[model samples]
Target chain A: MAALSWLEWNPTSFNINNPWTWSPGSDKKVCFVTTGATAPFTALIESVLKPSSIEALRNQGYTHLLIQYGTAKDVFSSCAGAAQCNTRKDSRREALTIDGIDFFPEGLKTQFKLVQQSKGLVISHAGSGSILEALRYQVPLLVVPNTGLLDNHQEELAVAMERSNYLVRGDVKDLAPAIQKSEDFKDKMTQFPPITSGGHRETKSFADIMDETMGFLD
Target chain B: MPSPPPLSALYSLSFLLALLTTLLVAASLRLLAILPTTHTSAPLAAARRKHPHATRLLIVLGSGGHTHEMLYLLRALDPAKYTHRTYVVGAGDAFSAQRAVEFEREVEGRERERARARGDGDGDGDIEKRKPKTEMETETQAQRDQPTPPRTLRTGPEAYNIATIPRARHIHQPLLTTPLTALSTLLYSFPPLLSSPPLLPAQPPQTPYEAAAADLPDLILTNGPATGVLVVLAALVLKFFDVRGAQSRGMCKTVYVESFARVRTLSLSGRCLVWVVDRFVVQWEELEGRGGRAEFWGVLV
Candidate 1:
């Protein structure tokens, strides 16, 4: 139930329900961050919007920072001002357009697509739904698990996915290192839903197992 | 007479206790006999002659992550093989139910396109029949170019039904009252497990989907959610009593797939039903042979 609530959360962001309204320019590189919607990870919003993390993105040629802040609007706004100020002080290039959304209510498909098209990076909370969606776009993903969660499944999954080279794992306290690593991770990441999983052993797809269990030989 | 009985060893309280213990042990043995073991179950299923007819597949959709992975695992679902589908969702979970409808529509759309391609007379019927791109690549081009033999098409709204049951335990519910709510959910699961209503009652089953709806599901597929565990329990009760010859007829065969999110350990629901389910599957290699017999078939989703 907590998982499904992401779709029903109220649209409290300044941007309208249509995400395309505040579109980034075609040439701008976007770095998208999605915290959990039902139980908003305020710490993630704070960390990603930290001055050092924003500086890391700017150093990597990023032009936009879009955060799906969930219910942490106050945290987003508080750090967003300082982050923008820091970017403005060094004006060699265009300022990073910083924005926040409480939730999409539908999905983050448009955001993922935008990141894919821009050759940008996606930093998401280590929820399987977001990880699976982000990986489908074949874009570089940095998954940060909330250490505050009672169960450590988020950390366990993030570590395992990283071991398989599917995504990079980030610490909630410091995301700059992981953000910097995303640039090199794109080419080395494994194609997800792997074609040849389980090594030399015969690997059957889910459909094959269904047919086998039913004894449908054909 | 009462005084005499008090002194007799034959009428002692210890003897009565022993009788009760023996009965309890016997009941447990019977229960274990009915539960399927992986080694014996698969071979028995494979030994059976192929039906090649109407088959009903029941799928349990959990909230969020489970539903997402369940749909991906079923991406190559062949409607022509499993003719009818029954999707079980928790009450108030409109998202999962809506996703089920959307999935069916996608199946219907694909089938329509497949039929149209066959009608175009381009000799691409076999190509259209194949679903997975990886599997298609392995077959010779000549084999794929051959015309596919016509089969019954099972797609659209009437071919499937979405059954919703109340949540077994609401979030933050008091632990003391969980059993009562879970029991109610178990009771509600019986109707869908028994048999789905035929598409049209007056007429005999004309389509494979209609025939399947009138019969018990041949398979119950779950991805180890709370609601799914209870549904499997209800099916186990049916098997225990051989209701409607469910056990003898091989209906309600349970398969529990551990979520892909669980790389090393099983989820709570998976831990509960691992031994009970006929086929327990885990995605990660580290989890293989868990619960004595969990299967690993690569990353399914």
Candidate 2:
């Protein structure tokens, strides 16, 4: 059975051999990606984000796609070394890694480019830093919030962002539908004026009150 | 018998001595009775008037018996002027069913009787005959209406109600243990201390006022010190001396309804004694003393 499954599998792995080789296409589609480090990845992957979503998208005639595995190494490892290509194994799923992406360190690059020369939507686990980055890029964002973390603060943040029309939010169960509806989702993004930083000034009035009380005691 | 030693002279001397002794005893009794006992009436009255339209007035008492007295007083008040809100706080489960229920039933029954009495206006003979039948009907109705009495006597807004103050169920347990423990501790610890006579400081003799002042700290600590060791000491002392009369320290409040016309005179007589018991008798007197009606509403502690 194992040999038969391997014969049916065909894996195509991409390698980033040189920097500046891949440039972003004019389509301007991007995805900001994160998976909550503290959340249950097994449940998210198996139960919520059913592996059928990626296969369905590929069958729909979309060639270029970006998958950001985030910092959840256990979840990323769970997707590696399968007998059948693109088919996840319950036993050896913990060793999976993204095939074509460069594992660059933070602050090394502010932008990302693809070898396929295609602009695509950004999909990420709901994290504030990732959301802010997507917003700065002016790309339509699809955020899947980790409900298992921190009293569901991410869910609240997702709702607030939805109200502002900055991102589209969904749970892992609805991730495939969310990805398919990304084109229709772009019209809902609200336009906000750019904001400047560093305008706050501090006053020493509280210090004066403390000094006066001390002086009275003296 | 030598003419009985001049009977008239002997009789006069004996009568004179008897009269002198009687006068001295009367004078001493008067002095004891008039020792200028302080009253809390003025402060309490002022507090009541200041919050006349209080919407809810919680009369928290330690037991069912005190709650009964408070209910009686509230019923006597002009209901129109102040809709009374009363609660009995600290009654035990047994007393809650027995005394508290009985008191409430009686108060309600009396109100019904008073309502009936107002309509029954006839000759003395008619009133006498009709009154007994009316009272009997009220008793029967009360029994039927209140098959089982509630544990709490609450009168206020349905949302916010106060529970009565709780009376100590274990009142005697503490009394029994306190003196025994004190005596045992002293007995156990005293042997070694006898070697140093000058180590402990001498306690000064205190006047009654000073003693009472000293007791205030303990009173504050215990919250209800009157019912504890103090009551035990008082009872023992009274029993030893074989003293009786008005031995109760009456906690009375006299509310001088300035606009007396607003008050129901008939209701007032049953609950409150109308006689003025001297202004000086009250702890804090308020008349026109403070020069303002709003400012000197009443004294409250």
Candidate 3:
């Protein structure tokens, strides 16, 4: 009945650098983290999750931090500047740098081990692909819908996920409360079914028009 | 001749007079039928008065009789909003474009006078008179005094500077004259000949707009489906009647207002209207949907 069992159905390991990465920790609590150039999640993580707020949560004995860095553009370039600033600020949360690995690679057993050692939390931009990955791993998600791009699509997705009781939708203005409620949020993630479509149905539906227009016209 | 005041002659005279009166009535009705009844005369005159200085306006001429309606609409527009830089394309004689150029020249002259008045600071000497050694004047002097250097001068017309003449240049070229459409020029020029009184006179065509308004059709044909039908009908009628001087009139303009109206009406999923109240944000999806529609019809701020 547990949502974590769904990960076994599709046993595809994920690349750590991807916006979605989840693994079982030593405490057996699933943790995942996402950081991409997507405005909503990035804004939620960087702007909303203030260092002071993170430290306050850290004081409550939360140790692991799964950080997703720039999936929207070139990850290294986008996050390198911000990573330097975070280091200068001496933020309390540990930064796990993941870049380049899109999906789970062959020789990443040690990385999984490290992930299992810390009972970290998963954070993700409201990309349906990333959300599906997180759900497959049965990792509780802290969803930050990117309002800047995708217009209202991400907001709709995030609200739907929250309603399904699979994730907690974090507001940009108050990410601390969402983070503090992460334990309760993990309890809530168990209720929803795994996402089946992966957000390609609408695009597939529109693809038929392409063949009729372009193939015939060209 | 020995004239007799007979009853038969008197009866014939009265009958002829009655027939003449009926003929006059029929002729008037025919004239009225041919003339467009949708004449916004007062509105057009008001628009012209309001924008008397507007000599240039952007025009989109399509293939139908829409151009006629467009001109009517243009005339309806407060002329002050446009400089009347009119460009007519599609299927009509080049008369309107020619006339537009003349109108532009007149409007430009008026504009120059207005500009001169504004530039003449506080009733002082004219700005042109004040700026003695202007760039143009210096260039003119240099050109006038400079010797013609004989080394490989360009074979085309020589450039000259004349301060007395206006600096503005108004150029008009047939749209169909381009290399791609040059072959079709003959076909395009055929429509004007069939329309009521040729739109322009056969003199050194001094721009079509310079031709008397009475000579031009009341409408301008645009490139649209409906107007295209009208043009075909008018052409056929003219040919059947062997009429030489009539022209069709209709004009049209495409605007972006329709798209705005569409957005307001369609409220699909994944969209909710959000409103800000003081510092708090509230999401009222239903109200937002309705508001979006309302905003379309509301006057643009």
The model with the greatest lDDT is 1
> Residue B4 in candidate 3 has what lDDT?
78
Determine which window of 10 residues in candidate 1 chain B has minimal summed lDDT. B40-49
What's the TM for model 1? 0.87
* Residue pairs with clashing backbones, model 1: none
lDDT at position A59, candidate 1: 89
- After superposing all C-alphas onto the true structure, candidate 1 shows an RMSD in angstroms of 5.0
Model 2 compared with the native: what TM-score? 0.29
DockQ measured for candidate 2: 0.00
Candidate 2's error at A197, in angstroms? 16
lDDT of 2 at A11: 26
Interface RMSD of 3: 22.0
TM-score of model number 3: 0.28
Ordered by lDDT, highest first, the candidates read 1, 3, 2
Ranking by DockQ: 1, 3, 2
In model 2, the Cα lDDT at residue B270 comes to 17
True-structure RMSD, every candidate: 5.0, 33.6, 27.2
**Model 2 over residues A1-218: C-alpha lDDT tens digits?**
32132233222232334332345444222232444332433334432224565544443333334344433445544553221245444343231223323223231123333321334456656654455545555666778776656644467557666765667886677566776676577666764212212223212121121122112121
**TM per prediction:** 0.87, 0.29, 0.28
What is the C-alpha DockQ of each candidate?
Answer: 0.58, 0.00, 0.01
Residues forming the 10-long window of minimal summed lDDT in candidate 3 chain B? B273-282
lDDT of 3 by residue, A1-218 (tens): 22123224323444434343444432332234455422324454454335654554454455434343433335433554454456446555554233322222122233334443454456677765455445544556677766666445567657755765778887766677787777677565653333223443222111122112112221
**Tens-digit per-residue lDDT, B1-301, candidate 2:** 3555655775697788998899889766754553222342232221222212212222233332333333322334322222232332332434433444445555545544554443332223443456557677777468547644221222223212233322333344566565654343334222211111111237542332222211111100011111222222232233223343212321111122211111111122211212221111111122223112211221111
